[model samples]
Target: MKIVFYGVITAIALSCNVQAAAIDFSTAWYQVAQKNDALQAKKEEVKYSQALQDAAKSLYLPNVDITGSYTHFDKPISVDTPPVGNFIPSFNVPLTNQNFAHSSLNAVLPVYTGGRITAAQDIRQAQVDEAQSNYNLATRATFTQLVQYYFGVVLAEQVYQVRLDAVDALADHLNHAVKFEQQGQIAKVERLMAQVSLDKAQIEAQKSLRDYEIAKLALTKMLKQQDSVLPTTPLFVNNSVTSVTPYLTKTLTDHPGIAILNAKREQAKGMVDMASAKHLPEVMLYGNYNLYSDDSATGELLPEWMVGVGVRIPIIERSGTSQEVVAAKSSVRQVNLLQMQMQQDLSILVEKTYAEMSQALEEYNSLASSQALSEETVVLRQKAFSQGLSTSLEVADSQLYATSIRVQRLSASYNYVKSLAQLLSVSGDIDHFMDYLQINGIEVK
Candidate 1:
């Protein structure tokens, strides 16, 4: 008994794992979004962020330099002739093959920059924020599109199945009606009705098949793969949008577009600071060690070294202060307007999605009831016709109605799922979906 129980448990566990491995819509959608071509551009944005950080740190390091120079002499002076070599200069010093070598090491350390470094660092940090915001915006847009495409394919498949079932039911009814008419149990008109119903059902089935094929192509395009038979899976839905209001508010507050503008505004302010500081003086501490060698048969002058400090007071920079100030003010104004526009747009989107979700939920529920009732009517009408108490037309009509209701139900469900996704997207909860995908172990590819 223990062995049998263990075997059953193992089988159940494997089956559960297989089911869990099925492609979840939320997971597949996010994976496709993350791997999208747009994300590549966002990744480049992240690179720009790192670049900004590097630029900011650059000013902190001391400048070190090593230099060597060679000079040729038209006429060489004889230092041995007199003191300070003055006698050789008037006594006709002869030109000779002479080479002088000098090498130096220099270092510059900034004692003060009048806030130039501070302004520069602030600008770079703002740049990083801008890049991050742009990346986030692209990511959100891609996620929205992937959700739409993924759900579209799944819903199309369901509609196709519903139409197929309709065709089968109509075929069975038509076959029965023909036998009844031949046996003189039903009128020829009733048999004709059954035939017409079958024809209509088949037509609808063909159309649904075409739609299914198109949906497959769409899904394949999104995933960047070849179209083939799609696997069956239950549609995942977040029915509790009300429960996520707090999340929605949080995301909207920190939306990437607004952040991008804020970053730009900050950069503009930094530029203004930089421009103001440009008129101020900068102090630098510098040191240098020089080595010079004079070679001779008798004796040689040894190497000499020197060190110093310097200061640069900016009395004037041609149009530097005025131009930067103007640019900075203009940039700040532009960013402020951009932020306002984005906020307004987001508000409208949130309202529209909320309305859409409400309508979709109502429609889905209505279609669910209609499908159930239509299905029951079909069963009853078919049984009544077989007993010779109901006309063939009644059975055919009920079957067609049932099939159409099923299709409507599928469409309603699909729309509801999409509306919910759109709501989540506006609120910036897409990462939640991505996390679900990673946890499921389903790789994007």
Candidate 2:
């Protein structure tokens, strides 16, 4: 007994060591989630905001530009030449090429813009907001897909294990029946039935193994990795269903759709501000300097600058600025109505998810009981067969019934998990199922 206990301990220690050395599924899933493509896209969106904010600063700064031009006149203008019909004294006048080269540096500094610059800057800011909201939505989609694939692979592995166990049990039963037949305790028909059961179990196990491989490959592809020998151990998934009503409410209030609508409405309001400002006069301070060489030497090489206030009052209004204001107001009202509709839809989705989860839980519980009873029935049928009271068909039927019950149990587990996912998806946050998401290294928050 001591020797057997020591062997078991050594085996368990070795298994633990192997597990530690192997690539853990938790870390693998974490790496996958961290490097998701959608997250990368979201990170890129921050640059758009940075650029727009920088552009807004342009409104507060003066605009400066440098320009240079060169002009060459082949025939110079000579006032001494006379051309007449009667007394045509055609005097040959000498002309030289007149080459003009000038360079100027000019600047425009806005002393006041009647708020047009500010309105334009606000419009740019609204564009950044729209990009930001789009990125947020993309991240949500990527995270949800990762969750679905991760759980799917885990379920496939579980089913594979169940099939493997069935194969082994059937093989053992076949060997025992053949021995009993040789000793004349069981008929030839019983041995043949056992052999056929073992063959069917093997076939089922092979199909399940193939399915498991395919599922593993799919998950690997999603993680952006090459095909690999999948980890023998299954991924950890938390089956617990936690409350998500508060999160759902927050999501409805703060979702990307709402953000986009708000940004659009804000942009429309800024447009109204811009149009109204068009009616108001804009004031700008400007300065320029120039030097002329031959054209009467009009300007000196010294400084030339001017600072003044400019204004323009609209004497005639073609497009009513007041109409633009009214239109913008109407748009704001439309967006508000849409937001209300979204909230109502979200509420209905939450309720439906809750109902699905409840139903899944009930089915899982019922299947669990069925599996337990089927297992006991298998044991009783096997004993009856050994005592020569039950036929081969009866034993086979019991084993198949037990297998079917196990399959149902697995299906129930999958259904329950999927329903939980649906609930989290509508809630717009999966923190309630963070334990399952932890496989991909995603923190709930």
Best by TM-score: 1
For residue 47, model 2's alpha carbon misses the true position, in angstroms, by: 2.0
Which ranges in model 2 have alpha carbons more than 4 Å from their true place?
1-26, 71-101, 180-192, 227-244, 291-295, 300-303, 312-334, 425-428, 435-445
| Whole-model lDDT values for every prediction | 0.70, 0.66
How well is each residue in 1-445 modelled by candidate 1, as lDDT tens digits?
2234334434542442342223656556655766678788778878978887887888967799988877676656454334456553434333333655667787899878878798889888888888887887787777777667776767766776676677677778878888999999999999889878877776676676677667766766676654342534444433444644564575569778778888889888988888877888888888777654446321144335555678898787787688888888888898898888888887777777777777766776667678789989999998999999888888988888887777676666666666666666667777565443344422210
lDDT of 2 at 385: 79
Q: Flag regions of model 1 displaced more than 4 Å.
A: 1-22, 26-34, 73-100, 185-189, 224-233, 236-239, 243-248, 293-303, 383-394, 431-445
Each candidate structure's TM-score, on Cα atoms with residue i matched to residue i, is: 0.79, 0.75
Report the poorest 10 consecutive residues by lDDT, candidate 2: 292-301
Instruction: Give candidate 2's root-mean-square deviation (CA, Å).
Output: 7.6
Q: Worst ten-residue run, lDDT, model 1?
A: 436-445
Error of 1 at 68 (Å): 2.5
